[model samples]
Target: MRVKGEIDAYEVMAVNPYKALIVPRMVSGFLITPILTLIGTFTGILGGYIITVMVQGSNAWGFMGNLFNWLDMTDILGGIIKAAFFGILVILISCYYGFHVRGGAAGVGQATNDAVVASVVSIMVMNYFLTTAFFGFNI
Candidate 1:
């Protein structure tokens, strides 16, 4: 159960008992979030293009023209911001639970379950607050 370039878990704890294991994960999240968002955005637009042009027989030029016309800079920026925050939140929650895991395999399983549930809940709750903060409630 060893991966190349990966230190043994026990060895890591031995060398730095108080070290925060989440730091690298947080850094990775920051790096990965924007790249994922860009890929997802492109894939979504491509899917729309496929549906409109290939399936529905719409002109590609008109499909793209309408798509670009309807999408605004704010929409793209807001999505990126939200993605970044969500990435950070997910990493933080997972690391918090992972770092605190105890009682062997059972504890690891419990920690994983808790991390996933907490992350999803936090993301949903935060998304609402973030959306409201970024674009004030209209009602």
Candidate 2:
């Protein structure tokens, strides 16, 4: 949402809401979302590492090293591939609900709420199916 009459990075970067599949909204989302996802992944990894270190206590580095060693180039590639779909999910959900902000504060508020809710749900659902298809890892 724009504040102080200032358009967001998304607003400036997003394409006109109607064009093709890879429009500005999608492009911006694709660019920025991986960073957010990486933060979440790293935070989760750190928490798990700390817990393993404390609970297991004997071999924290060894465990983490082994887990990370499994994350080869193909694993990173798969993650990047998944992130692209997540970005697509976010942009489509947001733009689906948020294109008509000119409808006023109430409309904008509802749209923002819907955007967040839809993005989250879409990501969760898409992640499950995509991960299942790509790695057969049923999350």
Best candidate, TM-score-wise?
1
lDDT of 1 by residue, 54-73 (tens): 99998999988888899898
Model 1 clash count equals 0
Q: After superposition, how far is residue 13 of candidate 2 from its true place, in Å?
A: 18
lDDT of 1: 0.81
Off by over 4 Å in 1: 1-20, 137-139
Clashes of 2: 2
True lDDT of residue 50, candidate 2: 81
| Model 1: how far residue 58 lies from native, Å | 2.5
lDDT score for candidate 2 against the true structure: 0.73
- Candidate lDDT values, in order: 0.81, 0.73
